[model samples]
Target: MSVYNQPRKRVIQLIILGMVSLIVVRLFFLQVVETKYSKLADANAVLKKVIYPSRGIIYDRKGRSILRNEALYDLMVTPASVKKIDTAYLCEILKIDMEEFRKRIANAIKREGRVRQSVFASLLPPETYGKLQESMYLFQPGFELLLRPVRSYPYGAGANFLGYIGEINPDQLKKEAYSAYQQGDYLGLTGLENTYESTLMGQRGIQYLVKDNLNRPQGPLENGEFDTVAIAGKNLRLALDIELQILGEQMMKGKVGSIVAIDPATGGILAMVSGPTFDPNLLSGSYKALNLGRLLVDTTSPMLNRAIQASYAPGSTFKPVTGLIALDEGVITPSFGYPCHGGYVQCGRFIACTHKNPGHAANLRVAMANSCNSYFMHLYRLSVDNNKWGGTTKGQVKWTEYLGNMGFGHRLGIDIPNEKPGIIPDTARMNRRYTGRWNSCSEVYVGMGQGLLDLTPLQLANAMCIIANRGSYYVPHFVESIDNDKSDLLKKYKEKRDVATHISADAFSQVILGMEDVVTSGTARGAQIEGVAVCGKTGTAENYARVNGVMTKQPNHSLFVGFAPKDNPKIAIAVIVENAGFGATYAVPIASILMEKYLTDTISVKRRPILQRMMETVTMSAPMRAKSKVDSLNSVSYTATAGEELLKKILSN
Candidate 1:
């Protein structure tokens, strides 16, 4: 074998060397040119996660915050791959009992198993999250904290108008065909929140990542090459003035009804208050146990938003529209005559008038000032008075069309959600009601805003704006402008002007003059603003058979509608109190205070501090305003000479 001088041995050694060289070349090629799969494998080592951006904050017109963000975390877990977390550790870290922890994890397991996506925790505030993160090592790979934003209302009340957001369900997802909502996403449930939900709920953000076979996140993953930054929802600016809203609440006190205020010139809502309001903070953002419990079990039904939902007969308030309708159609004029000798005499029954004039006649101005029921009854029939429109049926139909023009019988298309399209009767409605045998007899009641007619406090307020504007108005809106996020709503509404209540400027003058008389010396005298020149109407409607599953002697709903600075109006408002006796008694006084708070910047003229202190003590219930409270207020008296100083301070400030 040492005799390697043989050719075959030399050849075998050469072949071995050649094979080794070939193998090395192949390795080099694979590493350099054919590295498609190996590069991916290397890149997949790190995981990239995205953090959500903060949502935009909502503010009032003056830049005061109405909505804000509080830190909260959602527990996200992958069920199929989750480590089957130990119940004891989770309970200890999450500050939950074992039973509750087990139940919660089980729910997540089931939901994720069915949906194939991660299941979100119910809700965890910042404090709870801090404790969990401290001991996060015990939770393992499956559990993660997804930083989230919850909508919050800071004022703590005004539930209905502000509304609430809830987790999006299957039904909502289908309806929101253009939405990117997941099952755990939130949606507005009512009021402005619902109407402007799209603007409020900003777009969701997504990040791409690579997971190993063990589902562990590798660092950096592509340096966020596959992620898009999340955009925040736009913040809104509102027309509502907070101080004015608070005064309305004080005035409404213990009553069960609503008050609506809007700018007559711009048709912007100043306030829409429903009594028994729940603190809005409880519904979203941050909530406390005591406040939530009180609201949840409240006997007064504080959760119901009566401002736009509850509808009632116009009562005497309807008198204005009736009078205007008659004048516009030329059935009555400034000089038109109608006899209301203390009442109108009709088929064996007397429609008694509250105003007694010795003569058998009164003009349109007198009829309006007096709010004579008989005058409206006769005037409303004037549309059908001649039956000149082909037939009596056609004539009644025309009258209905005219009423509908004044923004009755339908919704005003406001920005808030869940608003009702209030009921107003026309020919078909009457046919169904009276079985096709209806005429002026069935229709006369509508003239007085009775019969099947209905209007919400909001509707009444909007109608009053029409009176103030004289011909048309911007549709009433809670928001002055949508945040940049909702420019479309603001844009669309800007182009849309509702001019249904068209009338001659002269006709409005007569109506305006009559309304002035109401607040200056007539029924709504209590609503007078000392120097602001408020014009208004008072309505006392009687309609009571049963209430709350029982019968009672409730007299009527008290109502008042008005605008200020009679020469050139500013604010318009409507207030209603259920079973509240007289409009002047409660409703007018409240409107007067609200107007003063905003326009004059003072609540009362007599001893500003003392009056404020006394009024603050005078609560909705007698028990709250005790004898001790009155005695304490009475003791804080000023001399007659000093009263003038206080009055000047109140007026000037």
Candidate 2:
């Protein structure tokens, strides 16, 4: 009994001692050896602050910065730290009433809880910021002024394309794409800003500071050892020519339209102007929400980026495509001709031709030059009814496939957001529209750029690039490169695309020759520039809009598509003026002036009068003109009054 029981007791004591030693070591490590627990315990006394990086700068072609960052102040508040401060004094300095102050405080508390800081007043005006900065001490630990970088547009053009940044909404915060963003963070909402958001929004930094019981920052915690430094966002270099953009905007004043110019060599956008555009600064700084609200409610829809968004029938500007397609399909040759005394009357529907001359529809070049409806209508019919394709259904399928390769009826993958893929009627679509009883004659008007054919101004400009490049193109893009960037963000844009590889170069040359004649002796005579050969086509697209619950035909939309230096084209452009008369009147002159300015960098003295007249022209309806605030909003550089005064002075001279 004594020997066996004593050994068991000793074993139990040894086990108890080992367990106690392990517990002592674990406690010592948690208390003194490890820093994780220490940092966790220090969290109550330390203030965690986020250091925001500077957003990227946007530069136009020729190294000009289109936008800049301006210093602005945001009044932030922590509900828990707020005490019996002079609310009336603070409201008076902020130019807000006591009720507003209380409401803001309640909202802040509701959003971020009692201790965390939330914005009380955002993007303060200079005067308000100055007043609040001087009296900041009175607010003590409750309120503080934070420096914020606000975007300011110097040129005040390209508002629709440049876009604006807005605070992240609750819905966006939950999305995986925006997971990195917080509720109070600002992000690109539309246009180019949205397209390059990740590149433009740099890495965020974290800073920990020692704070007192009252929540005022005493000093940096651990001398900023644990803080992360913010890296500023990369700068963006755009292909946009600011000067060209400004000129286009000035010419398009008091008009509802868009202009898109692309560099055919690189597919880089030189200038894109959406008329009735507002100052980009209006969507930034103190009055961002107010100005945005006004723009949203405006009848003219200045916020719409018509260059890539609005769809319209191509009109005669589409005639070249019909000829090219017909030539590629072997349905017609350059010498192919159709007889047109007055119009097309084969399908029991009369489609009028602009000219009834004896040889107006003689050969492809002549037909294109005259924009003869009969010739193209016949070409469309022949291509769609070709015996090689078996039937009309198969023929249309092949035709649409060719059109898709030509970058029609689909998005061109531009850099900006919200690019609408224009409509191109395919076999299935035609079948649905006509209940499967359709034939080539049912949609023959498409050959002349009408009837089930719709395209954006961007697509039109890009198609010209295809012709200008002789059957090849690059996807149109705004940002040419990003500073200090190594990402493949621009790889697709740099790659050359051969959209019309099947089409012969000679076919393109024949179409281009007709376009050249269009400026020289045909429809777009007003588009001629001395010493430079401009190949262009005029379009007066038929338009219909519902007014008073009834479909009514509005004024035709004036349009022109062209490229300069015909042989080695550099710039390709498309312009559309809604509800304006003939393309030769409004669109042709504008395109001519823009081309001359871009190629030579200065408008010739002889063309100054044309420029002045174009600047003074107001194509907007009288009622719309009265209701529009865009003219006043874009007063930063190009104002209507200034333009009128300049015109008067020019005329007097």
lDDT of each: 0.69, 0.87
Residue 70 of candidate 1: its Cα lDDT? 70
Best by TM-score: 2
The estimated TM-scores of all candidates read: 0.81, 0.92
* TM-score of candidate 1 relative to the true fold: 0.81
lDDT by residue (384-496, candidate 2, tens digit) is 89999998889999889878988988899999889999999897789899998998888888999999999999999999999999999999999999999999989999999
Off by over 4 Å in 2: 1-41, 635-653
- Say what the RMSD of model 1 is: 9.6
